[model samples]
Target: MYIRERRRFVAMSLAAITLGACAETSVRPRQLAGADPARGRDAAERVVCAACHEIPGIAWPRGRMGGSLAGFGGRPLIAGRLPNQPDILVRWVRDAPSLIPGTGMPPQDLSPAEARDVAAFLYTLE
Candidate 1:
């Protein structure tokens, strides 16, 4: 009976360890260490973030145009609705124009991965 109990305990422990290992096997997001502004600019281009909003390095409208997202990270609220968290930012990037009416910013239509990358890039600013 003692031997059976020990075997069961060992099996459960092994299973728990295997599950923990699996949980850690996902692609870790890049650390939030200050990213290269230039690379972020490139990422903005790839995601076409400048199509609506004026990004840092992308060639944007010369005159009075869309709202300047220069200090977007510092903003207290997104469109005065959602708080600026990574998940919230991803959601906003994925669907903003729909989320808010009369918002000049149109949805850039990014995938989950693309949105996450953009969020990481944006967090680098200040």
Candidate 2:
């Protein structure tokens, strides 16, 4: 009976360890506060962004004039200048030329809310 009890205790301990491991590794995608990725995707489509660059999960066009927008969340900078933060991203999206004169990226007419959504979607690219 002692041997059976020891085996049962070991099994329970192992099960607990397994569950803890799963909890530690179960990570979900990052989300920006007050930003909607779905709305951002829709905005991208409406703006014809694919005509100049390749954005993941946004198929069609996929022009080569600009860099691909994959893995943007991991990137250190946006437009190779500004910090890759939500506020900076929103400003850049709304008016790239204003931020950096003569920038190839044209000023998009997206409102602050729309820019926020786009920034949120970009943050999910990791």
Candidate 3:
């Protein structure tokens, strides 16, 4: 019985090790082949996000319209709420009202590629 128990424990440990090694982390992608902050800024300007949102230096209607995006990399959440995970930002950017009903920020019409680029730029605001 003692030998059998030891064998079972070893088998379990091996299985645990295998599972841990196979597990994938949930971190987001930081960059793409040609991610440009200047391009992203241009896109940001195109959407006129700063027109109502207080986005960093490109301020418009102050008082936290959508709040500043400076130091966005250090933030754990966006819009004073929601996790700052890259995927979450993608969703928010793509469909703000859908992510959170009654959210003050409007859903800016950005294509998938454009949104990704914008996210890449935002990620760099550390």
Candidate 4:
């Protein structure tokens, strides 16, 4: 099953890349250059992102309400509303409703650095 899923992911990734879904835009370094994916992974656990998001590496929680972030890095948009770029992701992580009024996601208390770390980790899902 794992092999099958991996193959499916590869096929979908190829399709997305062919269709320009994963193209780097003017807003680049989508994962935040110099930010630490390892630290971000740790921060994700501390921040309890897994409480709402089904993050890639974290095992517990497996939240159903906020939806899975399985392939979020390759996705073209954030919250199906905004372009999925680094700055936008950082802002979204800091405060989701500010970016889009009435967004289901609530504002988080992470510092700017922590937000960057979380964004960095999230972008690794691709």
lDDT of each: 0.63, 0.80, 0.69, 0.82
Tens-place lDDT digits, model 4, residues 3-109? 99999999999888656644554334474867787887887788777788898899997777789999888787898878788878889988999999998888887
**Which sequence of candidate numbers ranks them by lDDT, best first?**
4, 2, 3, 1
lDDT per residue as tens, model 1, 1-126: 999999999999999976754444232432434434455556668766665566665675432355657766665556667556666676677777666766766677566666666777765554
Worst 10 residues of 3 by lDDT: 21-30
- TM-scores for candidates 1 onward, in order: 0.56, 0.73, 0.65, 0.75
Tens digit per residue, CA lDDT, model 2, 18-98: 675445323344345788988998898888888988999998989888789899877767888765666677888788888
* Candidate 1 regions with alpha-carbon error over 4 angstroms: 1-40, 61-65
Writing each residue's lDDT as its tens digit, candidate 3 over 1-126 gives: 999999999999999865643331124444445656667666777888776655664545444566677787667667766766666676787788888899888889888777776776777777
Candidate 1 lDDT at 2 equals 100
Off by over 4 Å in 3: 1-35, 57-63
**Candidate 2 Cα errors over 4 Å, as ranges:** 1-31
lDDT of 1 at 41: 55
Candidate whose TM-score is highest: 4
lDDT, residue 39, model 4: 85
Candidate 1 vs candidate 2, lDDT winner: 2
